[model samples]
Target: MTKADLIESVYLKTGFSKKESAEIVELVFDLIKTTLEKGEKIKIAGFGNFVVKEKDSRRGRNPQTGDEIEISSRRILTFKPSQVLKGAINDSNA
Candidate 1:
């Protein structure tokens, strides 16, 4: 869901003011971003792990022009869902 939807849901569930809920959501996201910037990982029990991964520079083809190009390496954020979360999703789908 979108950020607004998440904020609304949190507000409803916790009986918090809209502004308060929004701040909380923003803070959580900011914390995650700051932590990731430090090249660290975040793990939420029964949810998932957030990590930053390094990518090596590589050659790539331009789709439109079919020209060779050099792709610069960069760090990317990734998430791997925890086993508990996977099981929960599987059970729900079942």
Candidate 2:
């Protein structure tokens, strides 16, 4: 869902003011971002783990031109679902 949707849900569930809910959500997101920026992982017991992974430089082909190109390495954010979450999804699909 969108941020506004989340804020509204939080406000309704916690009886918090819209302003407070928004700020709380923003703070949580900022904390996650800052922690990931520092190359650390964030794990929620029943949800998943957020991690930053590194990609090595590699050669790639340009789709349009079919020419060889060098691709620079970069850091990417990744999420690994927890076993509980995976099981929930599988059960729902089944």
Candidate 3:
């Protein structure tokens, strides 16, 4: 869902004003962004883990021109869902 949708959901659940809901949603997202920017991990029980990993530079081929190129290493964010979340999703699909 989009940010607006999330804000709406929070407002409905918390009985907060629209402005307050938006602020709450924005605050949560800002916290996540800042934590990730610091190369830290966030773990939410029964939800998932957010981690930042570093990768080494490597050689890669240019798919369009078939030219060899160097790829610079960078930090990447990854998410691993909790077992409980996985089970819930799988159960719903089944």
Candidate 4:
């Protein structure tokens, strides 16, 4: 779902004002962003883990020109869902 959808859900569940729900959603996102920027990981029980991983510069080929290019080093964010979450998803599908 989109951010607006999430905000609405929170507002409905908590009986918070629209403005308050928006702020709450935005604050949660901002916290996640800031934590990732610090190269830290967040683990939410029965949900998932958010981690930042660093990759070294590497050589890559350009698909268009078939030229070798240097790929700059970068930090990437990854999410790994917890076993409980996985089970819930699988059960729903089944």
Per-candidate TM equals 0.92, 0.94, 0.97, 0.96
Candidate 3 clashing pairs? none
Residue pairs with backbone atoms closer than 3 Å in model 4 (clashes): none
Q: Write candidate 2's Cα lDDT for 26-77 as tens digits.
A: 9999999999999999999999999999999999999999999999999999
Better of 1 and 3 by lDDT: 3
Give, for candidate 2, the lowest lDDT window spanning 10 residues: 28-37
User: Tens digit of lDDT per residue, candidate 4, span 1-94?
Assistant: 9999999999999999999999999999999999999999999999999999999999999999999999999999999999999999999999
For candidate 1, write residues 1-94 as lDDT tens digits.
9999999999999999999999999999999889999999999999999999999999999999999999999999999999999999999998
What is the lDDT of every predicted structure here?
A: 0.97, 0.98, 0.98, 0.98
Candidate 2 local lDDT, residue 45: 99
Model 1 TM-score? 0.92
Ranking by TM-score: 3, 4, 2, 1
TM-score pick, better of 3 and 4? 3
- RMSD for all candidates, in order, please: 1.1, 1.0, 0.6, 0.7
The residue-level lDDT of candidate 1 at 13 comes to 100
Instruction: Quote the RMSD, in angstroms, for model 2.
Output: 1.0
Clashes of 4: 0
Number of clashing residue pairs in every model?
0, 0, 0, 0
